[model samples]
Target chain A: MGGDFHWVATEPSGAGRDILPADAVLFGNGRQALYAVLMEGRRRFGWRVCHLPAYICQSVVQAARAADMECRYYRALPAADESPDWPPFQSRHEVLLSANVLGFSGLDLVPPDWPNENRIEDHTHDPWSRAACESRAGYCLVSLRKTLPTPDGGAAWSPLGLPCPSPEALIPGHAAAGQEKLAAMLLKRHYLSGMAVEKEEFRAWQIQSEAAMSIQPTSRPLPVTASMLPHLPWRRWRVERARNAEYLTDRLLGSLTAPALEPDRREVLPPPTPRRFPEQCPFAVVLLCRNRRERDRLREALIQRRVYPPIFWPLPEEAARRHPEAADFAARMLALPCDFRYTPEDLEEAAEVIREFFQTEAG
Target chain B: MGGDFHWVATEPSGAGRDILPADAVLFGNGRQALYAVLMEGRRRFGWRVCHLPAYICQSVVQAARAADMECRYYRALPAADESPDWPPFQSRHEVLLSANVLGFSGLDLVPPDWPNENRIEDHTHDPWSRAACESRAGYCLVSLRKTLPTPDGGAAWSPLGLPCPSPEALIPGHAAAGQEKLAAMLLKRHYLSGMAVEKEEFRAWQIQSEAAMSIQPTSRPLPVTASMLPHLPWRRWRVERARNAEYLTDRLLGSLTAPALEPDRREVLPPPTPRRFPEQCPFAVVLLCRNRRERDRLREALIQRRVYPPIFWPLPEEAARRHPEAADFAARMLALPCDFRYTPEDLEEAAEVIREFFQTEAG
Candidate 1:
C-alpha cells in the first residue's frame, strides 16, 4: 500500500455518474469482462478467432484461451501513435481487439477499414476520454478495479445498444475475493492515515484477492462495487490525472535523450510524445530508455527517491517471440505514476528524480 | 446469518489459551488440515492407503484423493455407540481415521486393538471434550472455523508429540478467503444485534469465502485467526453447548418413539443417546427418525416453527452404494443445533416445535 498506489475504500459522495454505461454488465475483474464479451460474441455473432495486441497483459491472452477462441497477434507497439497496423480481415467469424494503451491515445485503435461490428475496444486506462465516450466499436470494456477505489469491478457494454450478456448470479469465490480486496483497501486507508495497521497486512490481502479473482473469471461484480459506482468522482479523478501526466511529460521532455548508455554504437532515437491527444487522462507519463539496462537503472533511481514507477508489462514469451518490436518497446519503457493519488508537488519530486538520474548517468 | 449459526467475530479477551496445542499447524479449513496430515503421513511413513468412515463429508474423501492416497471405507455408523468395529489394518503402509461424531462419544472411535501410531482422529465437533483432550492418537485435526467465531481456521497436531508438518506460508487466496469470512462474521454480529444490515450481504460473504477456502487445501490460517486462537473463549463455549444439548435431549426423551411413521411394518428403533458421555459438548442433539420420510417431515415441521436442524450429510454416491446402512443412518438422522448461540428460552421453543412435530405425526 505504501510502495505503490493501492486502492482504498472511500465514502460514496455521489459526486459523479455516467463513468460507465447505465446498462454495463459487471464482472469480477477486467479479464473476466473480456472473457464474457468474447464468449457472448461467439454465441451471438459466431466469432471464432480474436486478433489481440502483441503488447498486452498475459491475462487477456488467458481470457481468450479460456473462451476456447483462437487468438492471433497484431502489431500495437507503444511507439505507434495511431491505430495498430491492421492484419488482413477474414470477414467471417473473426474479431479484432484493440486497446487505448495506457490512455496515451484516444480510443481510435480500431482501424477505419475494419468492420465496426467485429471490433472490441478496451478503454481500461481512461474510460472518460472523449474518443471512448463516443466509441463506435461493437463493444467496450473497462477495468473499473484498476481506476476506481473499489475492490472488484469490470464492466462491459455495447455502445450501439446491441444485445449484451448479463453476468450469472454472484458466485461465492468471487464475492469473497471482492470482500478480501475491500478489506485490504480499508486496512491500507488506516495505514495511510498514520494508524497501527502494517503495510504487509494490506499487501497480503491485495495479492490473495487477486488469486481468488483470477480463478473466477465470469462472475458478477461485488455488491459494494455496484453500489459505489454512481457515487465515485470519476470525472474529477480523470481531470487531476490528466493534469499530472501533462506536467510530468513537459518536465521530462528536455532530458529525454540525455541517458545514452551506448552513445557510440547507436543513433539516439527521438522519444515519443507521452499522449497522442491532449484530451486524454493519461494512465501515466511514460519514458523510453536507450535499453532495458538504462530503464532498470532509472527505475532503481526513482525508487531511491521514493518514486514508485511501474513497468507496463514484461512481454509474454509467445508474444515476445512473435513480435520482437513489441518486446523491445516493452523493455525500453517505464511508466511514472500520474494517477489522482499524486499532486503537483509529488510529480515535481518525481520529475527531479528522473532528471537527477539522467544527469548523474551523463556525468 | 440468522437461520443457522455462522461464526461471528468477537473481541479477543485472552480468556482461553490451551484449546489448541502450542505448536499446532494451522490451515485454511478442516479439509485442508486433513489433506496436509495425509500428505505428511505419506512423506514420513510411506503410508499409501487411508481408511475413512463411510458416513463422512465428501470433502474428506476429496482431500485423501488429492493427496494421492487410496481410500477404503469402514463402518463408523452414527448408530455405533463406542468404538468402530475393527477393519484389517495394513500396519506397514495404511492409516485409519476416526472422529468423535457430533461429540456424542469420547475420542475413543479408534479400536482399542489398532496401533496408535497409525490413527488420525477428528475433533471438529468438540475440541474441548475430555476424551479429545486426552486423545492418544498419532494425529488430531479440528475444524476451528466451524466451532470458533473466526473467519477461517483449521488445526493439526500430534497428541503423542510426534513430528508435524507446518503450512508452507500464507497464500493470497487463503488470506483473502479469511478476510471475506471475517467480514461476513462482522456483518452477522451487527445483524444479530438488530442492525440495519441485510442478512443476504453476510450470507453471500459466507458462501463465497467457503468456495475460496475449498480450493486452497494446504495453507496457513489467517493472521486474525492465529492471533484470536489464544484468546477465544473455547472452554466456556463448550460448556454452554453441552448444557443446551443436554437440556434438549432430556426434553425429547419421552416423545422419542411417538413418531412411528409406519407403525405396523417395523418395531420402533430406540433413538441412540445424543451423547455417549454426559460430559461431552455435543456438536448437536441428533434425533434418529423412523425413516427418511419421517425425517423429512420432521425437518419441515421444525423449519416452519423456526427451528433449523441440519442433516449431517447425504452420503456420496460411492459410499451410499458401498455401505447402505450408513446411507440409511444419514437419511434418518437430523441434528438439532445446540451450539452456544441459543439461550435457554430458544432451546425451549425448539424443543416444543420438535415435540409438536412428533405428536402430529403420531396422530
Candidate 2:
C-alpha cells in the first residue's frame, strides 16, 4: 500500500442500473481486487468461474483460496486485432466478473447482452473509467489504494441497493493499527535505498499487527473505512502520464519496423472526456507483440534500464483453456508505463533504448 | 522487540574460567552458542532431528525446519510450582533441548539420566556454568549474541569427542543477515520506544535470510563449530551478569522477610571453576513467587514502571505427566532482568519493586 501514486476523481454515476441480489461476499487487498470479485461468484453462486486475465500477482489466487473458490485463466485478444472470442461459461454460473484491460479497451472485449445475474465489475485498473460508471452490473468494487497514496482502502457498491455491513464486521482491527502502519511506511519511504533497514522495521510492524489480529476476540462488522482518504493530484498526474505514454508510443512507432498497429482490427478507447477536471488517470499504451519471446526480450531490456512496465496477465493454464483469446493476447502483449513519475525526456530515452535493441536484433 | 525500558550492566566478576560446552539448549534467536555444535551433529551423524520448543517465531523454527527437520512443542503448562514436570519425549526424538529458567535455575529438574539419544545443552543463562559442561550423550550449544554485542555467533561442543561437520555448511545468508540484525539491535538500544521498529526490521532480515536458504544450491559440508572458539568479551559479559544477579538477589532478600533462596532445593555449583568462564551471562534473575497470580501481578507492576522481565514458562498438565517435578517449579517461577544493559542502580530499583510487592502481599 505504500507507494508514490495518484488518483483521478469523476462524478458518481448514480444508482439505478441492472441489479441482482447477492448473499455474503468477501473482500481482499488491492492487488487481488479483481480475483476477489471473480471468486465471489464461485463461492456464493456455485459458479465454476474460470478464464481470468493471466497477468496478476499470487495474492489474486490466494484470495480465491481464501474464499474456497477455484480460478482459471482467460486469453486476452491482441490489441491490434480485437476480435473477441471468449470461452463459454457454464450455464450454471449465475455471476460473471470482467475487467477492462489496462483502461485501454473494454467495450471491444465484453460481450453485448451479457447475462447479468450478479455481474461484478472491477475498477482497480481504471477507476475513473465511465465503463464502470455506466455499467449495468449488480455490483462494482474499487481499489482506492491503487489510485491514491493511501496505505489501504477499498469500496464495494451494490446497484441492488443492498446496504453494506457495519464496518466492525468487515475488519475488526482495521483502525487499531492502520494509522501506525501508515506512519511507519511513511518513515520507511524517507529512507528508500535503505531497503534492508526499512524492510526490517516494516516487518516488525507487520508481526505486531498479525499478533493483534490473532488476539482479537472475534470478527466484528465494519460499516466502512471512515477516515478521510487523501486527495490525489489528478490533473498533474494525468497530464504527465498521458504525455509520457504518447511520446514513447510515437517514438516506438517511428523507429521500430515491427507490426506497429492493426487499426482495422483494434479499437482504442477514445480520449477520456474529463468529467470533474481537465485531465484524468492516464491509460497505458498496450502493445501486442508478434510473439512471446519478443515481448520477454523487450521486458528484460526495460528492466535492465530500471524501467519496469506492467506485462502479461498471469492467466493460469486452466483459465486459458476457457478463454483462449485472452491466453493468446497475454502471450504477446506488453504494457508500457505512462505515469506521473516519468517525463517526456525519459520517454524519449526509453524509446531510443528499445529502438537500438530491436534494430540490432534485426541486423 | 520494542520496549520502553532499558537494562543496565552490573560490575564485572574478575575471576576467569573456560566457558565452553554449555548446559542446555534454547531454540530462538538468543539461543546459547551450543547450536553450532548440534548443526555439526547433523552433518557428522545424518540424524533425523526433531527440536522441541514453542511454535513461536518463524526464524527460530526455520533454522531447524530449513534443515528438513521438524520442531514440536509441549503444550502450555499451567503453573503449579516453579517448574513443570518434564514431558516424555516421543520415541523418535534423538535430542532434548532445555534451558535455564530464563537465567534462574538450570535444568536440574530433569533427572541426570533422562532417556534421549542425546541431550543438547543451551547455556544462554549462566553460560559460564560447568555443572553440565560435559555432554552426557549429546553436544551443548551456546549463544554468544545474548551475552555480547556480537552481531551473530554461536558454538556447540561435545565432551564425548564426537566429530562435527565443517562450519562451511552453516548457511551463509542467515549468518550475514544475523550480523546485520545484531548491529541494528545494538544501535536501537540507544533509543527508547523504537525497539519495536528495530525488532521488526530484524525480523524481516531474518525472514529474507531464511528464504535465501531455501534456494541455495547444495554445497560442500559445513564444519562443526568447536568449543575452543576464541574469547569474545566472555569475562566482561559474565562478570557483569553475575554482579547484576547477585545485586538484585541481595536487595530482594534484604527487603523481603521471606528468604530469597529456597535453601531446601538449592544446588549451587562450586565457584572458581576452570572449564567455564568465571562470570555468567546474566540473562535474568528468576524468582520463585507463591503462585501464578502473584507472579502475574508482580510482572504487571514491573511493566508499569517500564522494567520488563522475561515471561514465565507455564507447565501444562501433559508436562506434569512426564516430569512431575517441573510442574511444581513452573508455577512459582519469575525471571528478573540481569542482562548487561542493566546498571547497579536499575537493579536496586527493580529489587525494591519486587520487595514491595511481596511485603505488601505478606501483610
The candidate that achieves the highest lDDT relative to the unseen native structure: 1
How do the predictions measure up, each by TM-score?
0.58, 0.47
Best by TM-score: 1
TM-score of chain B of each: 0.90, 0.60
User: Which 10 residues in a row give candidate 1 chain A its minimum summed lDDT?
Assistant: A262-271
The residue ranges of model 2 lying beyond 4 angstroms of the native Cα positions read A1-98, A105-118, A127-137, A142-156, A163-285, A290-293, A300-310, A314-328, A336-352, B1-121, B125-281, B290-293, B296-329, B336-363
DockQ of candidate 1 is: 0.10
Candidate 1 CAPRI grade:
incorrect
- Displacement of residue A306 (Cα, Å) in model 1 is 8.8
DockQ by candidate, in order: 0.10, 0.02
